[model samples]
Target: MAERVAGILLAAGSGSRLGQPKALVELGGETLAQRGVALLQDGGADPVILVTGAVPVTIPEALAVHNPDWSTGMGSSLATGLHALAETDAEAAVVALADQPLVGAEAVRRLIAAYAGGASVAVAAYDGKPRNPVLIARGHWPAVIELATGDTGARAFLRARPGLVTQVECGDTGSPDDVDTAEDLARVRGVATVRSEEKS
Candidate 1:
């Protein structure tokens, strides 16, 4: 049997620059939080989880875990998601950002594949640069949680332990572009439109 890998979406950002909570932001008629869950689910993750902060979000598709210290940043949300999963038997978890809606499910699949291939840590890379949808094995959760302080999320731990991360090439899969501002969102939406038209 395949190991159970949980999917975690970090949607706690207030998106002060984007003018609203990123999780609540809309793209193609779906909230970022909702779309993020579907991305994980479609990527073959079981029991997808969305970490909510800065705003109240209730998505039927995901188990929303509230981070009371969300104001501190992504680190708290990452810790929150890991703690929530510690209760379960999942061997690993795929962490993603809500603002990066353009990241494809294929990235998640590749990270999971890396994890299955004996890599305890996997990061999706676009155009040779490591990006979102990182995969971490359960054994490394404690170290990750300890380093996950402030807005850095897993970055601190990942940087401290570069040898553990397996960069999965996913540039062909999708973009890790962030919707941090209105202009960025517009650009991402435009890219999405082009991709959709291409698919059709």
Candidate 2:
């Protein structure tokens, strides 16, 4: 059967460092959560899932799943998303971060393309450096969940099984800069302004 790649947006974080929830952060007119859903959908992922925690977020065309244990960190949200996707017919999932508004849909498409090209685990790479928008086949969901502790997400599992992962180059496609601190958000929002202007 062909792989059906879904999307998981980790928006559960309260963004304590940024003084609010990252998911609700506005960038160029849209909330991070809204942009996230569009990013995945535009990249061809169907039934994108947004894992919510610190605050409730409702994104259009996205399935919001509350993670009660979100206070633990991104790992739980990552596990929660995979567990939710397990109930669906999707054979794989492309995990993206809500705070990473700079990452484009092209990255997601490339990850899905990698999965279709025989990669069970793929991470979008920027200038040869592995980053977010990681794709993991359903077969490895259990391992990812088990190793996804703290804020590391699936880093432990990926590091432990390096041979099983594939890095898809996506540097030219978009940036992986995350909106973590106030300065970070301001910087990205400035870039966002430039991007919007260019489109006009």
Q: Global lDDT for candidate 1?
A: 0.93
Write model 1 residue lDDT over 101-193, tens digit each, in one string. Answer: 999999988888888899999999988899898999999999999999998999999999999889999999999999999999999889988
**Candidate 2: tens digits of C-alpha lDDT, residues 1-200:** 66689999999999999999999999988999999999999998987999999999987699999999999989999999999999999999999999999999999999999999999999999999999899999999999999999899989989999999999999998899999999999999999999989989
- Per-candidate Cα lDDT values, in order, are 0.93, 0.94
Q: Each prediction's Cα RMSD?
A: 0.7, 0.9
Off by over 4 Å in 1: none
Error of 1 at 193 (Å): 1.1
